[model samples]
Structure formats: structure tokens, C-alpha cells
Target: MTAIQPALDGTIPTTSSYAEWVDDVRPAFVTAARSGRRFTTYEIAKEHELPEPPNPRADWGNFAQSLVRDGLIEHVDFERSSRPTGERSAVSVWRGTPAARAGRVA
Candidate 1:
């Protein structure tokens, strides 16, 4: 993961109601990073087949933000990818924290 720790101190409020997303998503990201494989928000969102009607990124963005805030993952690169809306855009690739790069995490 990149050394882009941007003061996650106040990024997520305790009462933000996004706790569930973090709970469900953090493990998967840790698993992927532990396996030495990198991914992007786009890939994960698409994999879950989430819809945008309720929210553009639905819970995916919330989950990713929570991980980033908790020091579990960070941006590694950018790649052109397809969005859930069928639009192509440059997306940021992310990986687990250094500790999770060993490919052995819960």
C-alpha cells in the first residue's frame, strides 16, 4: 500500500451508519491483499453487482472509505475500468496495508 495516510483521524464518524459496510468489506480486502493480489474499487463494486439507484456507489464507496480510514488499504495505481453504469473511467487500484501483503490474513 502507498504511504498516503491522510490523517484518517476524523474521516469516519462513529455514528455514520456505515459500520456494517466496513464490517463486511474489510475482511475481503484483507484477504485479497494477503494473497498478494491488488484490486480497484471498481472491480469489487462490480463483483458485488450493486446498484446505483439508492446511491452512486451504494455501500461500496462507504466500505472502501472505511477501509482506507482504518489503515487497511491504500491506493496503489490507476487503471481504466467499467463502472456499474456501463461507463469507462480511470479508477484507483488499492492494496492491503504492508502487514497484509504477506498473503496470509484472516
Candidate 2:
């Protein structure tokens, strides 16, 4: 007779576990932002040494979104001009919070 298998249960894994990852990167982000410099998601990820998965789905973007949502960071929009001769497009800039700024001052 063949052995019977147990039924599988439904459960979902979380991506927010990466908040620690975000925290790890927060210092760098704060430092840069406090200097009045803006950072892109890619830049922050690289600075923090975050590992990317084979399949990309805005992990960094989500983290950034969360930061903005939680009032930790502010997003600034700017226009970027095309290379030699062309039009301009909107680009995003990030700014740190008061705490982050104070941390830098200290």
C-alpha cells in the first residue's frame, strides 16, 4: 500500500520582513538626505548591500513607499532633461525627516 500524505495548509510569507533590511539602509539614506541630496531606490539598495532576488518586484520601491507612508521620508519631484536635445521628464527626490536631520547634525 502507498503511504498517505498530509493535507497542505495555506499560509503566506511576508515581504515586510525586509523592514530590518530597510532599517539597515535607513542610516545611509538619512545621511544623504540630510545633506540635501536625493537618493533613488536603486542607490539606497546598493548602498545598503541588499541582495536582490532573481525576480524583481519593487522590493526597494515598496520600502520607499512604506517610508513615505509612515512619514519617515518625503518625496520630491523634479524634471530631468533628455540627453543632447529633447524634452524633460519628472524625476523623484527623497528627503529625510527632522529626526534624521537632527541625527546628522549630532
Candidate 3:
């Protein structure tokens, strides 16, 4: 349920298939965050071979922002995305919070 929440203060709904996909991929995202390594959404998706959500453009942002809201991850920097579709655009870089690294988040 929380996983399906919107990106910024619930302005958008991550419902239906996108929400289900977000639920399925959340464990992987949390695990990666817990590693304490800086990463972009593109990198995590590639490393885990995750399937794209119903709306790739908005869903990924929504998911990452949700994690930020949950205090599992924090934005640390920005980097050019590696995904071809990203077209060298800057993407947020994130790492796990202390709570997340200590396994306090789920």
C-alpha cells in the first residue's frame, strides 16, 4: 500500500499494474539501498533486471520518491543516467539512510 503511494506528497497515484510492479520490485530496491552504495534508479533496475512499470517515465520517479518519503533512502547526488532512453539526462543518486543500513527499514 505504501509502495503504491505517489511521488511527491501523493499528488500522483501509482495504482493498478504499476503499483503491483512497484510492490514486487521494492525488496530489491531496499536491498540495494541497504548496501550503502550510491546508485541511480537506472542502475538498480539494470542490476536486478527489473521489468519496467506501466509508465516508465513517471513510475520510477514515483517509486524513488516514495522511498525517500519512507526514510529508507536519501538523495546524495546526481549523475547522468546509463539507460539509453535516458539520453544522458541527470538522474538522482541515492544511498540508504542509517536506519536502512541498520536493517531497521522494510
Q: List the residue pairs that clash in candidate 1.
A: 34-103
Candidate 2 is scored at a TM of 0.50
Candidate 2 residue 93 Cα shift, in angstroms, is 1.8
* Most TM-score-accurate candidate: 3
TM-score, model 1 to reference? 0.58
lDDT string, candidate 2, 1-105, tens digits = 111222354221222456544544555655665666666655554554444422346665676777676556778765463322355444466777665566533
lDDT of 1 by residue, 41-96 (tens): 65654454322222335566666676777666777888877654566778778888
Query: TM-score for each prediction?
Result: 0.58, 0.50, 0.81
The lDDT ranking, best first, is 3, 1, 2
Model 3 lDDT at residue 47: 70
Q: In model 3, what is the error at residue 41, expressed in angstroms?
A: 0.6
What is the model-wide C-alpha lDDT for candidate 2? 0.54
Off by over 4 Å in 3: 1-16
lDDT for position 30 in model 1: 70
Query: Candidates ranked by TM-score, best first?
Result: 3, 1, 2
Q: Model 1 misses residue 60 by how many Å?
A: 3.0
Indicate the worst ten consecutive residues by lDDT in candidate 1. Answer: 1-10
**Candidate 3's residue-wise lDDT over 1-106, tens digit each?**
1333345653334345977887778888899889999999878766765666879778889999999999999999988878787488888999999999999996
